[model samples]
Target: MLRETWAEIDPGCIADNLRAIRGMLPAGVKLMAVVKANGYGHGDLEAAEAARQAGADYLGVAFLEEALRLRAGGVELPILILTPIRPDQVELALARDLTLTVTGADWFRELRKRHASFAGRKLRVHVKADTGLGRIGFRTMAEWDALVPWLASPDIDVDGFYTHFATAGQVDTAYLERQARRFAKLMERSKASGIAIRHYHCAGSAAALRFPGLALDMVRIGAAMYGFHPARPAPPVELKPALSLHSTLMQVKRVRRGEYIGYDNAYRPDADEWIGTVPLGYADGWSQRMQGAAALVRGQRAQVVGKISMDQLMLRLPGPFTPGDRVTLIGRQGGERISFAELAAHIDGPAQAITTALTERVAKMYANAKEVRCPWNNAYFQQLRRVSDGSRAD
Candidate 1:
């Protein structure tokens, strides 16, 4: 690892999380493990392999390239793209056997014009119905039916039909019920019109946990599968978190009273205190708003007390801590723990964004039966090793 900071991916935990979440699903319902955004920055290939090993019925991603990466990485499972694909990318998607999201009839026509690019291979696709979210997909039944002729064009195959809920995890169920009804109505109408879809899914991680009825033929799990859903009203099914961010406190310096801590003198030492410089900063996805947020140092809370720089942040040590001491940015250090919710709240955002924002500079270490790199000698790795070995890490 080039940087002291790295994200540890616990495949065992992911496997456990998938098993727990899958138990809550209805009989015959499948799971499409969402590994988009590099498995939410936990390393896509590693998490995909883990999820597949844990009995994931399918895999999902946002971009066609992500599907290509998985295919290249020896993932031969059925993969679907959650987002719509560009007309130009359809050829590659067909070549790689990646499923495309059919948003509208116009997009379908564009794909047909380039149908010859498929090299005689039938293109697999999924129909997306925009129930309530004003994001993408067809809003009305007419929009969905407009593409009916193309569904049987022999150039494309509509393997799945799905929709997304605008509010699934919220306390209110009125809107959630409406979205479900709309999606069901549209899907039934399609069936009545002779559109045969192999798979039908609507629930993401939150929906699958909160509304078990939406577990149609498959449930696309992303955050919940990784165990990072810190939203209100926690999931009933207990999930093991699969990712943790950690860094090494490589420098311990004694700052005199009234001395500035970081950039622009944002913090001043009240008294002569020992400060540890953590070798991670905003550039590594540790946001600047995390200045006041505390990390774990030697099983104690170390409050961040300075402006976060591009490559470093300052932490007020609880006691005399030495260089090479471990720091927990989003995990447990002894009894103290820093959660994704806390970090997101510190930045006024959602929990999942924290992981996706992590850049490629931060190396990802996977804790599976198979090991790679084995770079760090930090406490996090030691704990991960124990956990991967089927012993207790926490």
Candidate 2:
């Protein structure tokens, strides 16, 4: 709380990005905004509200805890837990009326064994069909086919069928196409079996923009909605970045020649250099490997030097600056600008990981919005009730 560092979130940008992504979808195809991982560390309730206001058909979260948080925030839209809920969490998912992801029959059988938690309340399910991602979901046609009979049970309501593409945004989509073919074949057979799944979604940001044909009934849009291209060779659609990270210089010091800086003497000044200490480090999600990443100081790019410490990092300031001078860590400043994508490239990681890995110490501020819409903590849900009785007090 003492640090003058915080992430500013632009709700308007989020709305605009979703609109742009929506425009690219084929007619009749809906958009399910993925607000998982605290909306990629941009603030979940804020992003979810913006996406809902922008006409998102569904909101996606990673686990039952996030779904419950959204439900408590009065998010009434169809919220689906993208990850398969733990066996112990199924009851809470059903209790919150949040859709659950069913990977295979064995997971479903485990749920059935604990049916007493259902308490006569029907749980909506989404069959996660794994075409090629190979992490989770129905791997083979036989696995998917075997679950069809159990899906007909009154215990669980199968409402949607979808898959995650391994490489939807890359220039080469050979594997993505193969996965799409597998998905189509499965869907065609499911249709022949008379299994009426409501929503069929594949394609995240990249797949949806590159292959609209992959859009059946809905597309789970995530990174694109936040203005980050899911793949390189940018698509034609317009996207406005919604988040910007900022920090301030805590101390400015002059380093003489031959002076070693940081752990392991990672940086040695060949000449006298003005080094500014920024009160952010790997613990703040900047990552120890992020040393040498650039930040904007005095409207100019300042190269990070030395190894990043747990609570601090050194920036080679363009000139000696005051302690309170604002530093743009991942945003625009004067004529110079930096972005999460650039930082990720410096570290050789996905841009999303940079944002999502940001720790809670960093504050999140909202812009282009009237008031903050924060989700209630567990304190608000101390008095949990059954779904049959109207779920949470929300």
Candidate 3:
């Protein structure tokens, strides 16, 4: 029987991309693999495990739920929650041993009081100073300075200090340079106040490429490490595309003159012609606006026709066609290639449509085709091993 249509992710491609990213940094420069947004919609656990095996020093997620998912997947590497946790999540945060990012003195004080039992453990926390991003962070140097001394106490362990660049990825080099200068001054002021922190990082994917100085003690590599190059004068290094989408032709038929096709009579044949329908459409993350867009069929471009339905789309081929023929949606087809960025541009502008519209309807299978090892895969395996033999290997 044919399997349900799904997206096949290449863990090896992710591993290769991580290797390429690590090659660019200095020997001691730390690398925190940013796996937010479910590893950019590739499934976080699969991506996180591959990333750790490929030498990622740390894992960064946007919220507590994502971090918990990683830990549940047997990921023991330090996972940092990049977004601010509400006062309510402190107990959950403490229970999971997850690190929290603090932007204000009041927030830190409350976290310490909640974890009073683990006073000696020193709840791991990071400080966010607003250098110039004007986002969620300590807005002034005075705010950070006042908060630093409290951290010096035994209640907290300030593991890192960082900030975000407002326009690094979308602007020119000069804009990034100015942000770097402001960041440097902020670090200088923090040092002058005698506040010591372990890891200092601010450079994201774009800033890391443009300004190496921004990679102070660590760099949180996001989309770039996954083989995507954000906006820069030029990419700091070459990268690979880690994701590919595929489908198969379901049926092919000939239509009479002026015969309409699909819903709403959106497409009608000028004369007798052959049309092929593939099992993909808006419900599967293929936009309806791409009705006239193109796809790769037998190593050539074919125009889409009619309104895309929930589970199918029609394409007008040059001549006769057959079912089970390969269809390439976002991969190489001989000399022709269609990229996600290209698809996004065709449907809508970058901000609203492209990346954001790719829904989770596409199924994801691993390229290696290994059996997935989710919690349901086994019962009482690892903890039992740890208890009987005193070894923890799963």
TM-score of 3: 0.84
Model 1, 314-349: lDDT tens digits are: 999977787767788888878778887788778887
Let me know the TM-score candidate 2 reaches against the reference structure: 0.91
| Candidate numbers, best lDDT first, in rank order | 1, 2, 3
For this target, which candidate reaches the highest lDDT against the unseen true structure?
1
Per-candidate TM equals 0.91, 0.91, 0.84
Off-target runs (Cα >4 Å) in candidate 1 are 1-3, 116-120, 368-394
The weakest ten consecutive residues by lDDT in model 1 span 385-394
In order, what lDDT does every prediction score? 0.82, 0.80, 0.73
- Tell me the tens digit of each residue's lDDT in model 2 across 62-161: 9888888889988899999888877777766766788988888888777667774356777798999889888888877789788888787766677899
lDDT of 2: 0.80
Best-to-worst ranking by TM-score: 1, 2, 3
For residue 128, model 3's alpha carbon misses the true position, in angstroms, by 2.1
